[model samples]
Target: MSGAKSVSPENRTVIGLTFGNSNSSIAYTVDDKAEVIANEDGDRQIPTILSYVDGDEYYGQQAKAFLIRNPNNTVAYFRDFLGKDFEHIDPTHNHASAHPKDVDGAVSFTIKDKAEEDAEPSTVSVSEVATRYLRRLVGSASDYLGKKVTSAVITVPTNFNDKQKAALLAAANAADLEVLQLISEPVAAALAYDARPEAQVEDKIVVVAELGGTRSDVAVIASRQGMYTVLATAHDYEFNGVALDKILMDHFAKEFLKRNPSAKDPRENARGLAKLKFEAEATKRALSIGANASFSVESLSDGIDFASTINRLRYETLSRTVFEGINRLVESVIKKAGLDVLDVDEVILSGGTAHTPRIASNFSNIFPQTTRILAPSTNPYAINPSELGARGAALQASLIQDYEADDIDQSTHAAVTTVAHISNAIGVVSLNAAGEEIFVPVVPAETAVPAKRTVHVAAPKDGGDVLVKFVEGNTHIKVTKPEPKPKEDKTAKVEDAADSDEESDFSDDDEEEEEKREKVWKIGNTLAEAAIRNVKKGGKVEVTVQVNADLSVILTTREVGAQGGVRGQLNA
Candidate 1:
């Protein structure tokens, strides 16, 4: 209670939180009912951003505003790199913030000098940036709640591994807030829906498709007796509001160039492109409700104004690829859950992109008409489509507090429920005679958590080491090579200039053919490994792997028919 805020024995104030890649929100229970608490901006949800200018820190709208002026000092989309190393990040997903440099295998950003915009940069870890943002968020919540908010229940993606969870907890700790629970995003959404007064009390398979600012996650839930369980889940980072923003951004940039042929390219102007991105977001939101939207930015580039109009048809056309990606994720998750679309009773759409008309139409086209499409929440708190997770998380916070108090009251929405399974596949890597790596799945994605599977793998010739490595989810590595350039025919042109049938001495094969290898790097952390011995060539080894609801992985391996096996929790 002295160094950092703590829950007072007299007044216990707890909040529910949902932290997103681009935005975040908080809510609390008052009088046994949950409602989103508005910040200084009068909005339930705020931008998850932070900026440093001349050693002065800013957050939320202020930080977002600073982005256009000082793109390098402002950190946004830091959530994507949380719990990840520099090697794991795809270079194609780069943004305006200073490139993340490797600091002892950890991801960190080099913030350009805030005191003298052109001075050398300073370094900060990704978690440090997140901590700053969370600190601001806690302060805002405390101000709104009229007390010190000490504890929180935050929602995270189901596929989040232990490293990500730990990083999130560290951020909370830095803000002087105690983390009470870490609920899955889909589970939180389902909880919010089930708590609705109009919710039907029945057992049914539901698909919760959450299309957020920078990613889309689909989860299959088995709702029974007002309780929710996550069955299967899939996510597409490329199919999100950020993708739509790029499409709109490019369209406007092209239109601006067309209007002024002598104008410099907008992409080369950081501040101008930043402003364009902001307008693009507004245009996207506007197009969500109307058939047409216009993008305008005054003095967008070097005293030149830019404006463009986008019809729904064009918007849909540009977004077709992203829609297909989301569609695939939804289908993949349902398929991973071992259920057909016909088996699904309801398809609930959440997240900001769910408000888009075409996204809804796409879902309707994918699922049967009888499956029923649930729209965004019509709750009284004015929680946006993106705020569902936080709202539900906040509601769960109340349930947790009541449970801790030994007061299991129905009014608090306490129920007998459990998160039955994980959202992604867990497996080991194997190599065939050809030396090609193959992902031999042990516990397939969507398998119930607290589950285990034993697979038999043939032993290597003689007493070779038995290897049993585990990965958290599905992994795919892709390699691409640039096509070789065609050889030029300079001699042919010279001969044509002479108007004679004469050829130069230079050989057509003079150009050396450089061999190009398509490099493919596997992206996965080896969660566990094991050693085996004393197995014949034909004999197999039993490798057992189990993942619990908390994402702790256990791997055991031994020769077939052996009395004991080697086991490890794979914390590292």
Candidate 2:
């Protein structure tokens, strides 16, 4: 149960927030209608950016304005790395910048001190910056409502890990906001779609494609009466609004360099690159609506201005790969749900980036059912396209605060009745034929929560204590062996190759050479070990795994077919 469930709506000040990768917004319900709250600048969605001026902080629109003038002092895309280590390998994470550094395994930024320009800058954790921005967000909402706000329901990506969830919670706590519930973004969008007055019907298969600034979430949901069940979800970390921005930015940079032969490359200039990126975003948005659009950035490179025009055809050509990737991801999720494109009765499109014309064309190309597509502007009373997730979150908050057990049946919020299933397989560690430790998934991830499964594993020939290690996410986790040190002359080439993202040309083909192998990475905290004292070397042990709605994982081990067992809880 959520904390908001215990607080009556009349007694508590609650709001819903969407903490997106590149933007954030807040909303609340008034007279049973969801209303988005505008920030102090009168904007419903604010840029997820923060800038430091002489040790002082500026956020949102103000912070984004500093990107070109003070690139080192402004931070964007910090959300991508939250609850993540430095070694995480998404395209955004690998982009190097002097602004951010890893401090004691956490992300921190170095910013200038305006009070003392020549003095050394200071470092602050990413979480601290996030907290300050969240404080600003809630403060603005409080001002708009003319009341103090305490509780909130926030939305996150479907595949967020435990570390990310914990970090977000910490930031919310720092802002003096109690998170009533952290719901998945797709689930929230579905709730909003189903709540429409005209949407009443029998059970139907609905697919939601939410493309935001930083990521894309595709979910196939089964909605019957008022109950919603998530069948499967697929997402892409690299295919997003920022990636499209990069393409446009690169195109403009090339045009800029071509116009000025003596000027330094715009890509090499931090401020110039930032300016180009800002304009690139505007151009992309304009091209979404118009056949052709022109872009200009003043003083883009060493006092030289840049201006260029891109037609829709050219823009689409540049983004062909990304557009195709979205198609594949959508098809994959449908296949995972054991349904065909025709089986989907309705396809709801949400998020700001999904407004692009090409996205709609692609969807029509894939679904070929023009009438079934639900555009963002379908309802007059519905939440804004960009605010759909947050608005749905607002309704969920209301349901939790106002409704009793019996009265909740009419609510369309999925969090009230739906069970979000896991997306990957869970298994125990075992040795393969070549004696390499590998993961053997006994219970797949798509199983509904509050579910249990039992499997048996053979004891090692030497038979002492059997190790019970659970693996999650990827099953094939590669273990790279350290290459032997080569001669001094050969080391330089090896170093260059290692630093690059390309695969090495050298191949090992000796018949006797061992094949490269990988093992399953363990998940959660508890790794149980059961003693097999009197059993024979070839004996077996029974392992039972159970998952609860709270995501708690329990592992119980006993002798094969035995009743009593040793139990342990895995920490997530």
Candidate 3:
């Protein structure tokens, strides 16, 4: 977890926490900026794990290391089991660690405080485990902030039931953390993207794709004004980071077996399998940023040392189907929301698994060229996918920290679409994105009213007097087929064979073209207009639009680096 630094807690302020099955993060916001806090170990993405060894407790990344060495005494993958009964909880994810058992119809884990053979196992409820984890998380935040953090807006998956949320709240209370708000993960992701410096608060349908270590989840949301409504969601457990890691493990294991024919497979050996898995996971992460990564494991199987190297191309080739699976998951979730691919305006990739370039490229192929795909691997301005939720929660915490709890509840539960809105989109008529004279919306249609938005547009290249016009308008797609290219004369062959060899150079650029999409802004009735004169060359012009509930428009215009110019009000 990380961001542009702006914060510290004073007098027990609220923080933001994102507790996932595989990892957890903490963040705080100040001056409208959120910064993720690291634990004492200097780890931002702390693993959601706890371990017991020799009667001592460990948490976070430190605890993750003992999962293999003290498997039976370590607890993991219990986040989803909170407030869930034995019948509803799945134990497959905990097979490598402490196995959860049904105790009095409630899900619990039996783990020992010590790794000794004679140490008796104690039954720990999932709630208590979560409480302990939360306690540690708060402690870490306190140490960093130099003050106690007693409250937080923790994020949860959309599928979280009322009982689960209540259970989480109770756990947080036991851990000395007040539950400020339990926001949905996808909405939090959208909030984070909106808070970026260059991001425009446009109305769009966004798909938040979260590919975790154990599972993958995708949510389709409608973002209007400053509100986000989740339209649909889908979850898949079979395709995830672990599946990709297994592909690499299987590939390298085959190589090991070939080198030592008599050795047993690493999968059949417990110690060797652990070593192989650890190395394979590391290799997968390494290949995400670099073109090549090497895998090394000592005494992997039957006491045989294994060493191998795989390029990103080979690794991605082997995991092509896995990337395609993730892309398909996004597409399926969007369709589940009763919309096609074209309706999606933006896609935000969340979780550490999204670091893979192949996954982003696969999504780019599925989405239209106009669709903005946000990921560290795809968008230059996108934040780390792993920290999006936490940062969003922190920003939310900053937004409502001082409000009354009841008022916060009522405001959050209220539907944003219920508010009165203008009859048409109140926007500015100017140069469109393509330099075509058209209307560009600052505050889009269906925006909840009494709304105000500020936008900066390019003044004329050699600036002078800038007339900014406010119009009530909407955008419609304009489809146009390009004129056929001049047909190449295939019959006229090059006389020299060497000249024909040079023809291959242009082959890469000879891709088949198709129908193109152009966004055309359809101008409507003008509301008002204002002029700002004497703008510097290449300077930006600032225009502010405020659409009130009475269908009135207030326009403010000024050159960015100059004194204020003019303001006007017009009625519909």
Whole-model Cα lDDT per candidate?
Answer: 0.73, 0.72, 0.80
Alpha-carbon lDDT of model 2: 0.72
- The parts of candidate 2 lying over 4 Å away from their true place are 1-10, 89-98, 113-120, 376-383, 403-572
Estimated TM-score for each candidate: 0.68, 0.68, 0.75
Residue lDDT tens for model 1, 1-572: 12223343335578899888778898887765668888988867688888888878877878888878887788878786788888986534347755677999888888753577577878889888888888888899999978888788888887888788878878778878877667888878877777776667766778988889888889898764455667778888889898999999988888888888888878788888789888999999999878899888998887898777889888888888888788789989988977677667888778888877777666765665677777633223323566678878888887666343323222232232335555456667777788777667676544545567788876665646666666655533233444554549756645553542221111222222312222132425567677666666677888788776577778888888877889888541
Candidate 1 TM-score, C-alpha based: 0.68
Could you give the candidate ranking by lDDT, starting with the highest?
3, 1, 2
Model 2, 1-572: lDDT tens digits are 33322334566788999988778889899876678898888888788887777867777888888887766777777876678775662435323232567788777777673567687877877788788788989899999999988778888887787789878878887888877677878778878777656667545677888898878889887764445667878988777787899999999888888888888887887777778778898999899778999999888888998788999989988987777777778889989987667657777777878777777666765663432666533423434568888888887777676554324333433443356665555667778668887666665645556567788888676666666666664433355554655567566755654543121111222222223334434443224554545445677878777877776788887767555667878754
In the predicted model 2, the residue pairs found to clash are: 54-113, 54-114
| Candidate 1 lowest-lDDT run of ten | 501-510
Scored by TM-score, the top model is: 3
Question: Cα lDDT for residue 96, model 1?
Answer: 73
User: Which order, best to worst by TM-score?
Assistant: 3, 1, 2
In Å, residue 314's CA in model 2 sits off its true spot by: 2.2
Q: Give a tens-digit lDDT track for model 3, residues 1-572.
A: 11111123443478899999989999998678889999999999999999988878899988988866787878888898997989998787787788888999888888887657786778899999999899999999989998888788898888888889888888888887877678888888888889877788878888999888888989988777667667779988878998899999999999888888999999886667767777999999999999999999888877778899999989987887777678778878877866667768999998889888878877776778789999888899888999999999998888877766656666764432134555456778778567888777788665656778889988878898888888878655677775665557433432333453443221222323335666556789877778887889999988888877786778888888787678888774
Candidate 1 global CA lDDT score = 0.73
